[model samples]
Target: MIGNKAVYAGWKAAGMPDMLNGDDHFAYIVGYSDKTVHPQNGITRVAVATIFFRLLTDKVRDANSTLTNNYSDISRGIWYDHAVSTLSKMGIVKGDSHGRFGPNAPITCAEAMTLIDRVLNRLPESRDDLLNGMIQWSDNTDTSKWYYLVVQEAANSHYDDIKSDHHEKWTKLRDTRDWTQVEK
Candidate 1:
């Protein structure tokens, strides 16, 4: 079975408070509790999804703190609740047509790319050039596919308009060169 050390390290690196020692809620909120343990070898998809959302929005929060149960699949008090709610409110992510977030389901590559694109677009200093560059995926560019345009924009670099903004400052965490080389 995989140990908890990696999750602990990730939690700390994401600026989460170091309260995993004895706080059950903290561990669960950050997805590091004993319940996250996987007997086979790896963490569950829900656990990873919770962690991913936490890492992405650790430095941000919705002031309202309203409980928007947008997904029937995600219950209240789960590790990913607030993060998912906030992201959903910001339109960075969305549930399925049937109103299911499927928190436990593994995200497909198309979904991952679409999420990345949407987040980048939400950034104040979005790299439109990089996003509109090219079509990398050979098979998934159908306009009907939800991820078609997102993948195309994520793989291309058509604009170079640069400006200063909070998103620009935040995106500095990852170098621009990396986006230029996004996988097809």
Candidate 2:
């Protein structure tokens, strides 16, 4: 698994504008109170929520900001509260069967892929359709796995399409100066 610092550097190199200034800016990832991003540690669910929420346009966020959920673990004024609420409203994130959001839990691969699919609007209408397109990784052949179809869909996405989509978002952010400046 990649670390937070590497992910941040990669995104910056890929034309994602820095958004790590003060309170006016929205950082996609942030370090813990110890002033370290824990480069080798797995990312938590709340961190993922914050990242995706920062990646969203302000218009979308504003539209969904008032929406709320019933996750027992989420308090109203936490750092990730708004992000979690917005994502839950958009159906990009969900709590467990016990109605717990598990904010600090290390997110699983399947859960991450599901969030990606939801945010990208790439979820297939039927999992059966993706079986034929599946890539045959030795450990990934299990059709019953919940992530099977989403993983296959990601694997099958054309390189050009992915590049184009990323470029489009980058260009939009750049043009609008929507992102905050990183502190030097």
Residue-wise lDDT of candidate 1 within 61-94, one digit each (tens)?
Answer: 4342434866888798876777677667766667
Worst 10 residues of 2 by lDDT: 167-176
Question: Which residue segments of model 1 deviate by more than 4 Å?
Answer: 1-31, 34-49, 56-59, 122-133, 160-184
- Residue 57 in candidate 1 has what lDDT? 29
Pull out the clashing pairs in model 2: none
lDDT of each: 0.49, 0.64
Model 1 poorest 10 in a row by lDDT: 4-13
TM-score, per-candidate, Cα-based: 0.54, 0.66
Q: Positional deviation of 154 in candidate 2, in angstroms?
A: 2.0
For candidate 2, lDDT tens digit of each residue in 1-184?
Answer: 3443211111223443332222355567677788888867678999998888888777677878843679999998887899999889878899988999999999986787777666655565444344343346666677787777666554453221223333211111112221236423
Model 1 residue 154 CA deviation in Å: 1.9
Whole-model lDDT for model 1 versus the true structure?
Answer: 0.49
